[model samples]
Target: MELRSSLGSVATLALVAVIVAMLVGQQLGQPILLGFVVTGSMSPTLEPGDGFVAVPPVLADDIEEGDVVTFDARELQGGGLTTHRVVGETDEGYVTRGDANPFTDQDGDEPPVQESQIVSVALQFDGELVVIPSIGTVALALQGAFGAVIGVLSGLPGGDAVADGNVETLMVGGGVLLLLYSFAADLLGSDRGGRDRSRSRKGATRAGLVLAVILLLILVPATASMVIPSGVNEITVVSSESPSSNPTTIERGGSQTVTYNISNSGVFPQVAIIEPASTGVEVAETTHWIWRGQSAGTTATIHAPDETGVYYRSISERQYLGLLPLSVIVALHAVHPVVAIAAIDLVIAVVVTVVFALAVGFQPLRFRDTGRDTSVVDTVRRTVRKWL
Candidate 1:
């Protein structure tokens, strides 16, 4: 029961923190998203009942044709909001059209969308739009409930007393209270003879020193590599076709040659390797070396495996210090990019968690041998002070 309570408390605390941060950022006029889809104008791209996670728009010059954008359409027909892809750009603004629509918005009597009307760009992950389906339904339900309550309050004689919008403040306060409650609970557990009583001061000091050394060893080289300047390596695929000049299509048990143009723009010469590995599928492997401030052209023969599926061509630049190689892998499947990055992230998280647990575990125990009163309030205060 105690373990369950502790886990529940951690989850609740994390949820409250996230909510509070979102609300605070929204109130501060950040480009934080608080929108839900109600229309299907962008069907096949964004469906009805989808949730939007709005990101700050790129510079107007950076907004290229075919980019999906969300904007205010209050003055347009149907009068609410709209998100569409940019079809063409004009001197006036952007010519927007929905992916599933038969014609452009201009064809429907709406003028070209001005840059001033643009709100934000819908965020994309792994080259695909980020969307959470069915979440909009929950948002709509909450909006309806709030509207009904506000309507009732407005109908009352002393409406001003209840109609004030303090929801953000209330949420922030609730989050703070939740944090305090969690801290108090931890203190209470510690006071109830939950601490180990056999550890010595010398042992604790030695354990702490070892933990610090381990952390420094892991962090120092990583930090130094970032600060140090390494040669810049650039790679561009010149062609992926064999002698026939036709597009290279890898069928079952086939081979193809891909030519690449590699360049080095820094003081030192760089080596780039094209290694084939199974990141969901098998890819062809090759390598090349380029001189400083010069370019090199090389070809690699890629062999397709017997089983047919998607594949990847991983281009990696080898660094001098022998750290992890910087890689740019072209994949046949888009989700493979997200999966590749997420796998690396998961490994780092696991490593950090294990190291942290070991470091904390090795710390000497607090025996609670003193005769000083271990009352709930006193324990809570001590815990708060220690954390602070």
Candidate 2:
């Protein structure tokens, strides 16, 4: 009972968090929502698979130079949505650049970014932008699964002739019939088992309530996503030239400085990193890039490898998903790193429902070592109790 209740409580709390976050992030219907990094353009800072929350800018003019901001690409004849840093401010607009690039967006023959083109500013913590690393890969994987599922369905019995509409109708009808049978059986058997019947009905009522809440919460977002297909944008990444270590040759065990220029061209701010590819090399002073509208230089002191031959250093991007998911893996493991990427936010609520069942006082957790009582009524009680 305790475990079951904990599961239900977790689900309810998770659902509330998502709903509230969506509501707050999408304020004014600007479509500024949570998203993950899909490209390595922000490499060394925000690498592929990172996730971050994006909130719409309230005042475009308030957008300062050096702020990492997301904007429409059309303004520069670019692709879909692009996040880059504001490099310079002009009477015309904002000049942007990618940290990995050798030149600014304007140098590529594009005009300065205007305020109207701005979308959301990446969320920040302690004056530094935070991103959840490697979560976006899950969404990418789900897209792959969706295609595979379609292929499997198409190959079934009737092949292309197997209509999904027909299958759905049949499934719905079968569910309704099964539910009716269960209710009838419970009612008919009640006279012979009064206590059992009462317990069963109570369980059924709680189950029904939980199901209803879930459906109600889901219906809104599912409908919204369907209604606004354009609101969904693919991940975009931009990259620029990063610095390499100097004095290519160094005596074994000798020390040297590796300097690199890190820039943010996308609106999202990234934490620029300089890490050695091998344990033989050690670096110092790895700092977070503010990505404040311009390119900044980062330097790290490192000890050369004792072994001879070429070695490499990586400039990487990291994401901050906040403490809950980062500190505790299972807390946000719903966005599985390996599969089911498509489930994203929706599946999280479903996953947390182990707590939901217990939270609403529907089914109390059972931990007693008492003899087992695994009757069908107890199994089906949550739904039946409400109607009874």
Candidate 3:
């Protein structure tokens, strides 16, 4: 009898909470987005599974330090939101850190989280997150599942690692259903003769508008290559179209300085990889070589020694993203001195990858590592900037 009463009380509390949540969600409308505490952002202060009643600042004045919060993370992109503790604040924005995180965040000045970008904060804390530490992994797997399904449904076939036609159909069908529901809700009203005609017209307009939006989403990514000017390689890598003259004297053995006029033939940034023609020509120990942006370059060292009987710099394959082989991998040639052509391609890939890493949550080298890793089975980076 006591246990039954306890269960009844719990049920009543849950019902009240649900009613309150619905009221809050309806009143706040867009700013108050719902989320659950998956991990310990507040740590001892807050635990897992504690569902948060997140609300964007009613005004910027509402923001204060120590309030567990959620905001947009730009580099994370794609509707990504991070909920963390506001350790400090600047005139520009709030300084946030997760309880689990030792470092505050990557940038000295955290990205000024605009009010428009904020999702709601948790006001309602029940217990903790659903899955715990293992939850993030599950979320990631779900994303991969959605991404893979989306990839296949769009008619562009993706990797065999995740090829399920049913999954693809489900994702697309679900999206269509959601859009139709939204459109119908917008057109809901009385329908009688003239009123029915008006409703039909409104419904047509809403459906057309929704379909147009869906098309825009699909076409924007699909036709992005056309408008965004993809594969428009701005960087010119000079592969020795003309073979070099063979010289076998010590006049060139010592540290010899030569000027390489690297001109940016394309509209994009260019990169060059210079190395010895083969294992035969040694780039004398402590031999210095480097190139800057324009005609006059800087100081640097060559990556690979003389091998493959060729020395040339080509735009990183990564620059040519549209081209399958050339964009990611130049060529797979197993030659002596381990001068693999694909390895040379990596030097270009790495340089471009290192530029804007700090802005994003991930370090640049780490990201370049993905493409570099894929090629690792067959190659390595042969470059002037060895690890950059």
Candidate 4:
């Protein structure tokens, strides 16, 4: 019985972790470890609503032709993450095509896939994709249910404001409420009369689990804030003798200044750093501090080569929460963007850990044995009735 209980606990924790990863991935607009298809793009290989393991670019081997990858598409189906197979490579980028498509993505309005644009490579064995059937179907069902709940909640007073808030914020709030309800149900419905001290210790374990969930609730979005807004920005430069008024069009051996806007729509202030990611791109002011609901502009000079037709230059932007000193953040960013993100996340994690320890301590929460014999459902129903 104890062995079975332990296995159940492990399974529950694993499931929770997967769910949290999916939620975080959705908010970040990138798959963390898992991804699914909503359309029959890959068809026989990956049917609609099938899920697959997504290996992050950092962990995956070098991308090559025939490898299925999930990349940020700029023009395909109005721009989002698209999973397809790399069919060819070019000096510019990779040529990708869906398994069911007749032509390559580059044959259409979609540009060649850049390395920076690829988020994850689908895991495969012997060239066959490892798929989790119907997982996306389950995810879609849960999303529909959540939307229905949100619709009902929107009908309540002051709930319209909450419904209009950020989706990630809503997810965190819903998670907290669910955790609280589960804790309450366990406390109210457990049979306490004949329970031994060992059984009471289980409540402490449950409390720790709740704490972990709360920690994830706070950290996932924090990490996403630092990661999601940071990526490569591409600039196309047309070089010719007859230079146009456009900033991107310049005479050979000349340069033009292009202004880029950095905006922060979130509640937290962000520190943004822009750096040249490709040749012939130079940022005038590399760092900008954007407060909540504000925008900042930075200028970059695109230099055309002595003998040029058309060229592409990239500028990389990295953002972090305004939680640490600017100097420290800048120094960490100089090392690497990931290093800066890790440092910021580490600082936030340490602060949150210390706060939680100060408030809750290392001990498990103790629950009194009130000898309640009610079922969890009954208890929840009664509580809801009382509140209503």
Give TM per candidate: 0.39, 0.40, 0.27, 0.71
Residue 81 in candidate 3, Cα distance off native in Å: 3.7
What TM-score would candidate 4 get against the native? 0.71
Model 3 stretches with alpha carbons more than 4 Å out: 1-33, 36-61, 74-80, 106-117, 125-141, 156-173, 176-388
| Candidate 2 Cα misplacement greater than 4 A, ranges | 3-33, 58-61, 75-78, 153-203, 207-388
Range of the 10 consecutive residues with the lowest summed lDDT in candidate 2:
231-240
**lDDT tens digits by residue: candidate 3, 263-314:** 3334334333333331222222211122223332323222222222222221
| lDDT scores of the candidates, listed in order | 0.52, 0.49, 0.39, 0.79
Return whichever of 1 and 3 wins on lDDT: 1
The CA-based lDDT of model 4 is what? 0.79
Rank all candidate structures by their lDDT, best first, as comma-separated numbers: 4, 1, 2, 3
Distance from true location, Cα of 367 in model 4, Å: 7.2
Model 3 Cα shift for residue 355 (angstroms): 60
- Residue by residue across 1-388, what tens digits does model 4's lDDT show? 5577557657765676676566557656788678899998799989999999999775688899999999999899999999999999986678999999998998999988887788899999998899999887876776666667667777888777757766645575457545655565456335442464445543234546646767787887898788768778788888888788888889999999888899999887899999887678889899888899999998888999888687777898888998888889999888767778888888878887788788887776654444654444454466569899
Top lDDT prediction, candidate number: 4
Q: Compared to the true structure, candidate 2 yields what TM-score?
A: 0.40
Better of 1 and 2 by lDDT: 1
Model 4: per-residue Cα lDDT at residue 120? 91
